[model samples]
Target: MIGYVTIGVSDMARAKAFYSDLLADLDARVLMDLDRIAFFGQSMGKPMLAVCTPYDKQPNHPGNGNMVAINPGSKELVDKLYHKAIELGATCDGEPGQRIPDRFYGAYIRDLDGNKVAFFHFG
Candidate 1:
């Protein structure tokens, strides 16, 4: 069980703007905001997504094999989220489409901080 997921960013303002607009698709609002961190979630207890500067005060870099997957609840929503990310300047890692016939439909992108993120739906 995961409680939350956090990714480090070098520019807080840019990261905030990108996530604020992107996560709005899921109706997730800012649940918490501190000097160097911000959390977004649709409800309490649900997994919250956070973006922050590293506490060690060193430059931040994207992890090579780590990613955050977001489930927006439907194939249509997945497509919408994928498009929204691209519109907001995210680079595409995969286009919106079925990944395994009728089992999984998803899309992937690298966010402003270069962290991989996925929008998916299962049927």
Candidate 2:
């Protein structure tokens, strides 16, 4: 089972603010805030996402092929959050649409730190 995923960030303040505004649509908030890391989710019982400086103190770099996916529960929400991410400065990786006919609809983007994220609804 997944508890959380952490993305390495270059700027803590910017990362926090960006996620705060973006995830607010999903009702996620800062569940935990530490000096080097902050977690966001509606609650600890659900899977959470976090952003932090590298523990080794090295520069943060996004991993190739790594991504975090959020299921917003419907096609409209997938579109909504995708646009919201773009409005918050995320670059589009894929436009919101049905990725699999009659099955999955989704959108993808790279955040300010270049971490890949997906907004999807699966039926």
Q: Judged by TM-score, which candidate is best?
A: 2
Task: Give the alpha carbon lDDT tens digit for every residue of 1-123 in model 2.
Answer: 899999999999999999999999889999999979999999999999999999999999999999999998899999999999999999999999988998999999999999999999997
Per-residue lDDT over 67-120 for candidate 1, one digit per residue giving the tens place of the 0 to 100 score:
999999999999998999999999999999999988999899999878999999
What's the number of clashes in each of the models? Answer: 0, 0
As a whole number from 0 to 100, the lDDT of residue 39 in candidate 2 is 99
> Model 2 residue 73 lDDT?
88
Superposition error at 9 for model 2 (Å): 0.6
Clashing pairs in 2: none
Give the poorly placed runs of model 1, Cα more than 4 Å off.
Answer: none
Best-fitting candidate, scored by lDDT: 2
